[model samples]
Target: METAALNPVELEIARNRLESISEEVGTALIQTSYSPNIKDRRDCSAGIYGPDGMLISQAEHIPLHLGLMPTMIKNALATYGADRLVEGDVLITNNPYLGGSHLPDMCVITPVFWQDELIAVVANMAHHVDVGGITPGSMATHATEIFQEGVRVPPVKLFSQGTLRQELLSVMLANIRTQDKTRGDIMAQVAANRLGERRIHELLEEWGAERFAQSTHALVGYAARRTRAAIEQLPDGTGTFTDSLEHDGNQQRDVAITVTVEVSGDELFVDFIATDDQVDGAVNCSWAVTEGCVAYVIKLLTDPTLPSNAGLMEPISVTTREGSLVAAKFPAPVANGNIQTSQRIVDALLGAFHEFAPEQVPAASSGSMSIMTIGGFDETTGQYFSYVETYGGGQGAMPDQDGASAIHTHMTNTRNTPCEVIEREYPLRVEAYQIAENTGGDGRYRGGDGLIRHLTLTRGKAQVVAGTSRVTTAPWGLAGGADGKPGSVIRHGPDGDEHRESMTRFEVQAGEGITIQTAGGGGYGSSPAAE
Candidate 1:
């Protein structure tokens, strides 16, 4: 069938329509989810992919989740061949080795069919609060192996031929502590993907199969051309930088992450072969996450307005060592790696870019996600409760302006869980929530200030996990700027206040409280005082 060519106006319309569908899908997931992590913090992502598993459109959600969606879909298709997937078959998985960032992040994928032909796949990923791990949340700081993180779900059919797989769901829920919440969130993900499937079918019907395929092809090609053009603006050269994680839960030693970025003609190459080996802690990320970080930085530096799809990565190449921290092997604990190591990867890559494009790249941000999780049994409700959240810190200063205060940066784009929601859902109270005054680095354009959050166990005992970074090593500055302040976690109990490591898990009794202070951002230029 010959397809009609799309004019610029028609192409733009198609792009907006597809992007809007993804956004709508995300909104549905958020509104229907049962956990605070998904509904309140919006810790979820949605995207549409081609039949061959290439990303077509995505919601402006978490960068880490959005980047890894295509990989997850590809792995699912590989396991259950596209030819074998029926129209109503919905697949699910959260295996890091199988293209997932972590175990808690569950991926729900549904194939979209038109006229009995597989046209595309609509998918969404949501972070479940508890998935039956050693800790309250699945992101245990001391987890040394993948088995200890949470229940690992490989690519399998959650719904076949429009029927729910009750046995499969029962086996999954049996392992989770907060089974009701997890079950609700999982169904919400299914509903979101179903909505996406309907929207895609409507789009295909309106545009016709031939025109729809042609328009999508045109959209991807346009993104590729724009990305290549942006790369062409850069001078051909190679730049290198190294950054480190303060600790990996099990040890206080630093884990190094190194990157070398090469710009040639109209192409960009990123190499992480010099990075350190995977350690015994939970700070090692998989290759999918490494690719996500690289793609994020490239899109950020190149053209923020370009359509986000597989085409944007056409001019980019990323290479990582098989057993390195950026590309860990099986059995490696990777709960915190998804949140912490990914941030450091962005910092290192941006530092390397700063060497050549000093004017274009800003200084480093907080370089930490500052994740905290608390889980306990609620006597009043006769239910198990798990609370998980990532606090925002300082955003790095730009060349012409100051950094933003207490905001999610880089790979993470989630909002802070509201205090009311926290107190109502968990056996904890928000004692203090404010900005740490003067924590930002001083420069021509000062860096942003970090946040201070204090939470006290309201009743009974609870388990707490603090997974963070930027304690031993601070966010680096560019030009003549100064490094940002490091982060810290403290416990206030009957024995007085004790400091915690970058990644630690502990038990807190009633009346005891925990304080989390995130890291500040790096300054852009030297201050007058230093001059």
Candidate 2:
């Protein structure tokens, strides 16, 4: 099973199979999990990494994972030293500075053991429904630091020498609000990791460990070269784009972001130099997340055939201004950091790149995550429940075609929960769920249409924690296309009163109804002369 003797076609196939292992792990995490965020909202990612901490292959997971994961693996290796790991053990954490992006996003790392040698690590990171923060959903808009966010687990052994750590398990169950569900979700991640580990071992047995390791490295090198070539083709010059966050939870100040990309013969220099100061809100992000955002945009601009590993980001250089939203200082909160700002960063970089490669890039996308937090209880059944959902939006129109409507966008890969499933799981009713007509930005290729969802609070009081944009600044069109309509929210009270809602958290009392409408992306070009 020498590297050369093995069929090149087989080696490629093996790489693809390894990538699929990540998706399989994700499906397991979703199917057996207890929380909607894990099973329904689908805020998780599963991927395989080589012994050297570069991504091997993954099932098409969330866009956020693609940007943040390479660094996460590096953090894992740095913390554990990679040699102290053993068989039948799992490590978990959600430290923002470590392999984690935030408190809610729990990163689970397990080492793949092969004949008493360390070969690789199978890891899955998901947003737990609750982790004992100030809020039930663990989504606090006003937290000031990571400590206020939730439990900060780092590379701790859930299982040691093949035995479960019951004391640690008890502590977790006691701390989290959704105890039973969180416990089940944690085990689900462990199960998914084991599944991938078994598959990795099978591949090792078929090709032997040495050849497998060699192919892994070779594949990464191949991706890096291809990414570099993509950069080389772009005209040699520096271009910049800027966007903004409407406000922090304070809702009084606007946060800005500026990204300049220098393309010079196979090299890309990306810098976020004009961003604003960080705030005491859950909107700040770390340097790793910022780098991930840069990497994610390059992936969108590069050839899809290229492997998406750390190598693809190797030749590209990224630098950010200090005290900015992308590069937050310590003591700032960032529970929703990955979703709140990463997509905007991607959009900003693409905005500049489009000026150089119009044919290669599309117009602006649905620039916000339709994050909704709902809480209530079923009166007839008398069971308590509160949950949050981060929905996707329309994609931008491309050169050859129109964009998708009411779909996920930018750095997310989750599907909306079915109306039927929502009814069965909770005491809420989907009054209206359809495309918001006229929401797409008009162009030669029509922009994607956005979604409108109306629901009734049937039981008790419910709180909606919303953090979205495009309500103030509509999604922009390209090459003579019209701008898309802005997003809107309306709440109808029991007394037949209605109120327009802003982008913040508020309460919906019993007998009240709520409606949410998301915005669409802009089109690339104007329509051709009417037949």
lDDT by residue (328-401, candidate 1, tens digit) is: 99999899997899999999999898888878898899988899998988787888889899999988888999
Which regions in candidate 2 have their CA more than 4 angstroms from the true location? Answer: 1-7, 376-384, 495-502, 527-531
Q: Write the per-residue lDDT of candidate 2 for residues 273-312, one digit (tens) a residue.
A: 7777788778788878888777777777776666776577
TM-score of 2: 0.93
**On a 0 to 1 TM-score scale, where does candidate 1 land against the true structure?**
0.98
Predict model 2's lDDT versus the native: 0.77
Judge candidate 2 at residue 520 and give its lDDT.
86
- As a whole number from 0 to 100, the lDDT of residue 93 in candidate 1 is 91
How does residue 79 of candidate 1 score in lDDT? 82
